[model samples]
Target: MLQTLKLLLPALIPSWRFFDWIAPSPRIEIKVNNDWQEFRPRPDHVSFPTMMKRMVWNPYVNENLFLASCAERLVDNPADQHSYEQILNRILADINDQKVTSLQFRLAFIHREGNALKKDIRYVSKIHDVSGAQA
Candidate 1:
């Protein structure tokens, strides 16, 4: 497995910055207690690209592939109302594990228009109450 190799020989792999030039910069956000926070990986605190590249030994191995895939669907058709309850449920469980309440999920994209890059919020999930059954 890739995880096993990461532990045995960590120095062989290159950093995320090496492939940043070829990735699309996408913003992923999560809401806890009604507060929106950007989701960034720990330690290095690196935020991964929306569209991922398949590399055998990439440093961005810990990227949220689930979120990235879901985000792509949202970007492809912003108006499509898809039930991401499964994903939301997992996130809710994580929040509960952390002893937090209130939950929301959002994904944004940067659209290029001429020389300007515009931020477009493509997806925003409803605020779900963690106390009761998932909405």
Candidate 2:
């Protein structure tokens, strides 16, 4: 019994090392016209009622989280075709304006430096046409 308890102790207790090597996460940005913008910009603020409602039901928020995961996967493996296509399709769907012909996207690593946040561009995709065509 003593040996069994000792063997299970490490598994039962959480380790601090889990938080020690946190790395920067990736963000997806799309360039329209000449300006770059977040693919899914977070709302500046949410009312208490809306926040409470989101706790139970929030498809948009869930989808955005999935997209962020895809961006992270893309950053880890630039050649990941599924993630690349998923991001491209999602961005294309969001751009409703027919006048917008082409757009570019890039992956940025966002990290904190002391009190300020910094962004480092890691990959910039070729400009793709909005009409379900890759350029």
Leading candidate by TM-score: 2
Clashing pairs in 1: none
Candidate 2 lDDT for residue 64: 82
- Work out the TM-score per prediction: 0.52, 0.76
Ten residues in a row with the worst lDDT in model 2?
126-135
- Against the correct fold, how does model 1 do in TM-score? 0.52
Off by over 4 Å in 2: 1-21, 131-135
lDDT of 1 by residue, 1-135 (tens): 997787667467645465555345566788766677776444554345522443444544444665666677666776545536545655665565564556778877766777888877777877776666443
Task: Give lDDT tens digits, candidate 2, residues 23-113.
Answer: 7877889998889988888889889999899999999988887888888888889898888888888888788654577888998988999
